[model samples]
Target: MHEAVLGIEHPGAYSSATAGTDTTVELWCNDHCDLLHVGGSEAESVVAHVEDAVGVRERIAEGDERLLITDACLKEHGDDPIEATLAEHDCLLVPPLRYAEGRKWCRVLALDAGNLTAFYRDVSAEFPVVVDSKREVASVRADRPLLTLDSALPDLSPRQHEALLTAVEMGYYRIPRDATTAEVAGKLGVERRTFEEHLRRAENKVVAGLAQYL
Candidate 1:
């Protein structure tokens, strides 16, 4: 087994060098600006190690770290299968992990009831990021039209396929939102948390797919 490493990591440098079997789990607790960046890599017990470190992260954040997870987002994604899977190892679920040129998103996770709860999920494709020596946040806003569903929609996993369509049908993204998380959760016959995870993973995949066009 590889030796375990835990640290606050940025993938920009590591992306090109990362190899398969190089298991690095990056975790952030709370939303907005994540004060705590908990991660572990190169360990057989990565999940367990992260769980333990997250406690310290939580404690530290209690003092120096600041970010408040929204209850609505928690209710949206806390009970996903991934959440349960990580919870078994004492790892809380965080927001979707993504890497690309212009977009940035932030999400949060925490340990509660010995279970990992996730919340404060946000997605920003045109997020501002410091670029080059000039230190200007890059803006790649496409006031362009939404691409046709045929070309833009990603190849979905069975579960993602269901979740995205469900969100649309329920009007979760519609103006004046027609369905709340709880209502959509019921319609999908999933716990409010489970549905949220599904939705999160689904959205991540879609965004990741679209990012290829950049």
Candidate 2:
């Protein structure tokens, strides 16, 4: 497998409003539509800017995090050359696009390394795509049996990783629970339920991954 990363500026309302700010926007796409999580001290301001700019009326809030919608139609206007190039080459997106400072960063995992050159060519021709870096993942040899124990490590999102690490250091998992979920959440600047939910999900992934080989 090969991992290709590209960074490009977005002319959309969300990224434009967040540029040079502490606002963070994490984006995932489903059926070619965007699902956005906008969070930070300036989250509300960012949301307002996007809503006003795009004339979107829908909003969904999850604890301290807010979900906002983006105009998928904007991509057709050459805003999302990365996604378009991936579709053309049938490449898989390993990670969702990350937005910061008005730029969209994406990492894709491709089965055929040769696809990257074609994909890059198309994107560069169509949009102002910046090639951040590219590297090949060393494939495991079929003759050597690899241990499954390493799979015990959880596949955590950035937020989940932070929550888990904080809980552990604060002795949240210790006897009698030294740290309350609220306290931990406060320390992380998120809601208590949000912290607990992320922690539970992380624990579940770790347990399931470990138990599979047992």
Candidate 3:
């Protein structure tokens, strides 16, 4: 299978919400509504902007994060141009689509490289697109296990997940430690003690969950 990670310059509520903010939005869409997971320091504002821009059906807050159900699907808002184009070339979009830095990032899969290339060409003709990464997988079964990690790991609270991700992203776990707990806390707009508590709890849960595999 041919896999591609694409960055598309498409304007919509998700894109607009992430513009000029540290927020990132990940969403899974269905025929009825879209389920969005929003995070970062500006998460609340991002959610508000999305609600105003596209209207939300429901919203549930989780610490500094939010889970929102959109009133309509992306197809209903005419934001499925890329999906439609991909279908024309027999490509599949892997969920959940991510929005950050004012753009849409999608993972697409195609059985043939030719079809993948054709899909990219057709979509790029309408929207500015960047091929972030592309590769051919030897075995779909081999990669399928990676996708199941979410289920294998114990669930962390929204804050715990954010704390862990922020720490990793800041290189706090690097060999020499590129960042300190205080620095990570500042980035998340939280106290150092709070961040440490969240991170430690997350680490414990993750370690315990993976003990069997180890």
Candidate with the greatest TM-score versus the true structure: 3
Q: Model 2 Cα RMSD, Å?
A: 8.4
Ranking by lDDT: 3, 2, 1
Stretches off by above 4 angstroms in model 1 are 1-153
- Give the clash total for candidate 3: 0
Per-residue alpha-carbon lDDT of candidate 1 for residues 57-171, written as tens digits (9 for 90 to 100): 2322322112222222222323333333444545432233322121222222333422212211111112223221111112323763222343355534344567779989989
Candidates 1 and 2 compared by lDDT, better number? 2
Q: What is the lDDT of candidate 2?
A: 0.68
Clashes of 1: 3
Cα lDDT for residue 22, model 2? 49
* Per-residue lDDT over 1-214 for candidate 2, one digit per residue giving the tens place of the 0 to 100 score: 7777776674666568777764567766554456677755467877777666543445688544578766542343355546667888988766456666666666766778888777777766765677767877675557642212222363354566688999999989999899999999999999999898878867866776678657
Give candidate 3 regions above 4 Å deviation: 142-214
Q: Give the Å error, residue 183, model 2.
A: 29
Candidate lDDT (C-alpha), each:
0.39, 0.68, 0.82
Q: After superposition, how far is residue 33 of candidate 3 from its true place, in Å?
A: 1.0
